[model samples]
Target: MPKLTFNIFPKEAHHGDESVWSNLIGGPSSFSLESRIFHSISICLMGISCFYIPYNLYAGLYVASFSAFIFGIFFFHQYYNSRFNARKHNNTVFGLIGLLIFGVNYFANSGIHGSTDLIWPAYLLLVFAITPYRQHLKWLTGYLVFFIIVHGLEFYYPELVKYPFLEGEGQFVDRISTFPIPLVVVYITIKFIRQSYDREKKAAEERAIAVEISKQQILIQKQQLEDSNSEKNKLMSIMSHDLRTPLINIQSYLELLNASEVDDEERPVLERALLTSTNNAVEMLSSLLHWSKSQLEGPSVHLAEINLLRSLQVTLDMETAHAAKKEIIVSYQIPADIIVKADLDMLQLVVRNLIANAVKFTPKGGLIHVIGEVLAQECKITVTDNGSGIPVDKQDKIFSIKAEPAIG
Candidate 1:
């Protein structure tokens, strides 16, 4: 004898919010959408047949045996399709089973005037639930036309549909036994629909959040690129102004030398003036190059201890000579022993620009002062001149990018 196995309740392993059944069957045959519905319907039919077979045997063994065979075929079809085919054939299989078995059962039980009338509509509901929406009209039209033909046959040929029982009691038992099948179908169908809806809604919400995050990241990247371009433009503007000033002085001196006659004594002085302008241009070019490299690759700072006076000595001497032509008094008060931690090139360029700006603004014979003070743990450097002071209204903007160079 072959052993028989029966598993009415589904067993599944849980992974996060999903189960093994959802992973395996949810693609082609979703548990909440298709497989679960088919399984419930299959089990309901088999369970009903357990009671249906014995009851119909008393009425007639031929009817009971045929019902059993139909039930067996439906059970195996659902089982095989659910496991191997993943319920891909659910709509066609269940539609055929519902149409053929319920149609024949209607006449076999008692033709058009039986409990099959109550069960037929419920079976149709199962077919509608399992099948795709496109097949609805086709199946409904087929079932309705078949129903009309069966009724017409009963009216014209009364002998075709057999009445299994002759009285009220047999009819009562048959009707009561068939009631549970339709009820179970309705309950499971509703459950599967609700579960499928919830799953899809959750997936939609996750996708929406992911899209919002991507949009925010794109906005941040756009802002960063705009800032980078703005900084590059500002640096280029300042470089143009500073670089042009020294080159203009060099070109003016060269033109003057070409146009004018010079004695031996005056020629050396003009050459020294030209040499000073050339050195200023070279210093400005070096600063511009360093600034450009920093902007390109980001700033790399190396700090070391150095005497502040020693570092500024060459810069101060150069500015004094440059200012001597205008008769401006340039003086400094930094101690020879005063030391500070700084990047040497950056510190030298900063000091040179301050003095140069002072020389550019001061009138002939104006006094300029350079002072450095060490207080507690801080070193303060100040550049002051007796040139026209910045106006009160413009003082706040003196350090801003909009601080334009004024004509002396």
Candidate 2:
């Protein structure tokens, strides 16, 4: 025996919304307007057909046509009102009204004595095609109940079924040969309309999220600019106060030296004082130049492969005069063959600043040591001094703008 497979519900149970069904049922406001216009035109056409069907002078046909015109006007108003109000609420009422009109018109024109009975089923089919998903079960149940009552009555009272009133029975049987076809078409249409609405909703949500992200990025950039401006203002204040004091003192000392009424012994002592002042002025000038160059255009370097040992030797030689004046001994422990690619001028500035700082802060007979080593893909250089070390509290601020020498 083949294995039994049980499906508790059809695959359609898992199926969701569809656009085609929504469009038929007037899901969107635009589609509802279109459907309303279509319905109005169909009713008008039917009224014209009634006017010419059997004889043009029939009062019943004229009355039916007039009824269609009134209903058409009603449909137009419902379309606009539903659109103006919310679509969901109006569409529900619109579908209900359409069903009511179809049923009433069928009974009015093809009452017990009419000749066009086949028209009722066709009108019933139109309702099934366009009714909203929510109204499906109601439409089907009502149709089944009506069909049973009409056929039962016809069987009981055969005289009540007149010539045109029962004229289209054969056509009704032929049309309904494919019993479940309309139901399938309606289901597919509903599923399609729902999917379309879901896709549009998702795309709108994504666009909103992207806009929010862009706004946050702009805010972050604005904050960074404000911080930079604050830093620049603080640096300018320090430059103005610190640089002006030293220059003023040098000028005062020079003016005093210009007077020519001094003894030889006093002159020697004054000359020594002048020399010390000149040295202090030079130190201040050097600091200003270094700081200005670093600020104005950053450090310029010519990158090339250079021997680390040779570079250190050259740096020590350049600082020999300054080191001797301070009684500082500079030494290096670097491998001779260790080479690295770097800008010579930049490395020299780094080495000079470290060594000079050491000499400035060191006491007499203090020693300075330079060390270098090659590591994977990079090189490390360190300058150590046996002098007064920087205080722990000031270490974090050493590379900050607060530690920069005054400029102007």
Best by TM-score: 1
TM-score for every candidate vs. truth? 0.69, 0.41
* TM-score of candidate 1 relative to the true fold: 0.69
Q: State residue 44's C-alpha deviation in candidate 2, in Å.
A: 18
Candidate-wise lDDT, in order: 0.73, 0.55
lDDT, candidate 1, equals 0.73
- Report the C-alpha lDDT of model 1 over 1-408, residue by residue, as the tens digit: 122233323355533435544433334333435556666566666767776677667667466458666876777677656645544445776677767777777777787667777877777887888787899998899889988988898889888787876668977876786677778878878877877788889989999999999999999989877766766766776577556556666776687677657667777777888898788679768867786668656546768999999888767876776677689999999988888998876777678778877888889999899999899988899999988776798889877655766776
Error of 2 at 269 (Å): 17
Lowest summed lDDT window (length 10), candidate 2 = 1-10
Residue pairs in clash, model 1: none
* TM-score computed on alpha carbons, candidate 2: 0.41
Off by over 4 Å in 1: 1-72, 78-93, 106-122, 138-192, 245-262, 266-284, 299-302, 313-329, 345-365, 386-408
